[model samples]
Target: MTSKTTTRGEPAGPSMTYSAIQQPAAMSDAGNVLMNWREWKTLFDCYIIAAGKEKASSREKCALFLHVIGKAGREIFEELDLDDKAKTDYDELVLRFTMHCDPARNVNFERHLFFEIYQGAENLILTQMIRGIKGSYMRERLLAISKLELDDAVSWCRAEEGP
Candidate 1:
């Protein structure tokens, strides 16, 4: 099936791994695709978090995630074999998903925060060109033209440069 909805314009059964999730008939929000933890997180926030008339409880959030996950996704979650506490906690569920599914977690986004200019005759701005960065990475240090004692930050940049 393309999503959880079948070609016949009906909800696919649980047997389908990539089944489209059950959304409110009135709500036009397309439900979670269950491809990866990040995608799930984004869509979950949109659809299950507050998409309904009222706020969904944490319990409902977990159920929503489980409902959308297909056979392979379900297998991964089961393999984690979380205890009741971990299973119940939504944040923990996300953590488990990231641990199991996100492949590039080791590549620190901070390194991409800014590109240090070695020398500048013109106006100097410590420029950052972090492509595909998820969250904010701006600071006074990033904007300042004056020399700053940012040993750690310089180290991160230099590491990328190499010998």
Candidate 2:
């Protein structure tokens, strides 16, 4: 079943906002919170909703996104004008930022390369496992074998063995 929502039409969950994430204090507390890529991602969605810009036009959403980020994120992006031709979907903006800033974006593939048990020296993907050890060259070679190529080879062998 679907969950309930607030009278404001937001979820029953509390909405995230600049003030919520960045608490105000005395006048001396004058600095924007420079959110990391992860925090910005999480708050970005919520900010869009809370501001009632979830269904707003792409141009509006783009402007709101940039505004939600405010001064702290100005440095992260050099050029973002809502009137620009490239100003399209808000998701596109999110993608561009992720590509530029997400540090752990390739961590999973790197982890898999280091940790997957070598199937065999004859293994099509990990084709150079030498004697009971895996050298850097072998690991490098294994990384070179894209998952699509391995999948195609597996499919070919399976087809040859027939149903």
Candidate 3:
């Protein structure tokens, strides 16, 4: 649903803003709330949506997401709470990413790396992110984001957000 606001003494079409998940309206005014990477990822999705539209500046919002991700850093990764095995796999994935972010390589190569990460990782969360991609280009881009070498023909299934 769209969020409307009072503007010029009349209702505006919709507000070009969204609250952070940790700052949900249902929550009380209390201490700082901790958020997991999955939650942050959802916020990331919303930010992408808000930024992607023609009405808004997608690049600016995406840049903000990059900033937020960088600031969160280890905290974001910690919140992922992956098992020991998964953590090791994730670390290797990140290592590959660092190696491939070479100035000599094309940006498309980095994208391909990410795509592999998205597809290769066994983490349900990461897998779901890959499943979200629809079009071929988007699917390829998802794979390109983190080029993990997982087997092809892995079933694409919708990710469930448990309550």
| Candidate 1, superposed: residue stretches over 4 Å from native | 1-35, 103-163
Better of 2 and 3 by lDDT: 2
Which one is best on lDDT? 1
Consecutive 10-residue window with the lowest summed lDDT within model 1: 123-132
RMSD of each: 15.4, 13.9, 21.5
Q: What's the TM-score of each model vs. the native?
A: 0.40, 0.41, 0.24
Candidate 2 TM-score versus the reference: 0.41
Candidate numbers, best lDDT first, in rank order = 1, 2, 3
> Model 1: what TM-score?
0.40
Instruction: For residue 81, give model 1's deviation from the true position in Å.
Output: 1.9
Better of 2 and 3 by TM-score: 2
lDDT of 1 by residue, 71-130 (tens): 556677788989988887777887887777755543455333322234342222223322
- With a 3 Å backbone cut-off (N, CA, C), the pairs that clash in candidate 1 are 4-19, 4-20, 17-70
Error of 3 at 17 (Å): 7.3
